[model samples]
Target: MTKPFDVKIGINPISWSNDDLPSLGGKTPLSVALAEGKAIGYQGFELGNKFPREPEALRAVLAGHGLELVSGWYSGRLARRSVEEEIEAVDTHLTLLAFNGAKVMVYGEVADSIQGTQEPLYKRPRFFHPEQWRDYADKLNAFAQHTLSRGVRVAYHHHMGAYVETPADVDRLMSLTSESVGLLFDSGHMTFAGGDAVAVLARHVGRVCHMHCKDVRPRVIRHARNRNWSFLESVINGAFTVPGDGSIDFRALIRLLYDNDYSGWLVVEAEQDPVVAPSYRYAEKGYRYLRDLVERVPLEAAREAA
Candidate 1:
């Protein structure tokens, strides 16, 4: 029987090539990543550094591998820039997503993010005043409204070193922003921040337009916290991995989405050393695990309905 919701499985190229730390899989070609991902049964892929910038070129490249363009990350500086300036900066990226038939765009607040730096996670910049939340949300509301007009929704990514990292921070942002600003729910980052991923999702599932099905190793996270490791340092130490390979309970997560009638791409994204976790092997494992979990949800839902 057909499922009641439309939940497509996709993967981010970060598992094969780390964008922030390019040296990890910098030698691997984009073609290889696409081919391997397609072989693993992912319906699509998120944008990566090696992807073609031109719309037509990128379309052709993905088409060749029988994959769709899920979405691409946009480093938004709305925390420090005007809504108009933010819109201007995102025009090309918005155009690419729209032209490629993508429905959502990943927007990560990078105005003061330290995820890319060697700084410790605890050293991340914080919102100094309460008014900062109102100001940032206003800008996000405007930006998201404009992007929706261009045929793509904005999914705000609350990253590890960004201003909005914890569950409380996410709650505040969601409360402040209009519904136009959707959330890109990431399981790994949420878990890494020491928040209950399921509980957080339960509170804000309605605003989830996209999701990153990333998993976290609790041991690595504990070590990182104990030793004051940077975000990248933790990633290098195998803090993140594909779902089912780590401690996350994807079955519960998928069931919740299905119960909520969620519809969008669930992307398997993990920034790990390709050498330690061979891309194809790990990617295939994640794909199969999520596929089974997603498929099982509808059956259970049907039984409940019956």
Candidate 2:
């Protein structure tokens, strides 16, 4: 069946192997991950810890499965470093992304981040001073321009424990940076951080370049907040899940993107224990949910035309 919408579905390798904790899917090979993702009808994949670093090698491996490189996460420190320094940190990755034909680079701020730390989630990083934001935005503008020079756009990822965790933080960052810097809209992280996923997308759809379609288990989220769990701890405790298995209303979200002419990679990214969730099963679940949504779009269009 053909899809009505023009979005390509991709999967993050974190489902097959947890990069932060390693032990979750440590034994699973990259080959296995690619095979399973392709088998489930994913046309692309995001880079993870076990992915090949060299462009040619990565390209050959992905081509073997008829998949493409969607994007890769680049940990940014523009909040505390010079523009030159932040660019240097992601130069190699940017080169690889360009060589492999990726358009968006996931820029996540990790300056003093408590993402993987055992500390409480309440201690997650945040930038407070106006002067600090001015300096960071200036650096981000230069860095985005540098990446644009190489034909790749920067999509800032608002991660759970990073500097841009809340909806207000996203608003501030969008306000500070120029339109060249796009937003990597992630539904799961926004919900996990207590932000309205739909509201954020509605407000920033024009500035969104890439998207992450992950859902959350509401009870687990409540548990995490009540127990003062860290970001990684909440992930370990089953706070996130594939779209159909969680509480988020993805039908509405997908329709919103479709109506707004949003087109690009819609990646399914849920960092879970591979043993508990079973990578292949969850990947297939997410793929089916998205495919079904796309199939129904034509009907919705017909209704609108009527």
Cα lDDT tens digits for candidate 2, 45-98: 999989899999999999999999999999888878888788888889999999
Output the number of the TM-score-best candidate.
1
lDDT of each structure? 0.93, 0.90
TM-score of each: 0.98, 0.97
Supply the TM-score for candidate 2: 0.97
Clashing pairs in 2: none
Off by over 4 Å in 2: 1-4
Evaluated at residue 184, the lDDT of candidate 1 is 96
Clashing pairs in 1: none
Model 2, CA-based lDDT: 0.90
Runs with alpha carbons beyond 4 Å of true place in candidate 1: 1-3
- Candidate 1, residues 1-306, lDDT tens digits: the string is 546768899999998999999889999999999999998899999999999999999999999999999999999999899999999999999999999999999999898899999999998878878898898888899989999999999999989998999999999999999999999999999999989999999999999999999999999999999999999999999999999999998888888888888999999999999999999999998999999988787888787777
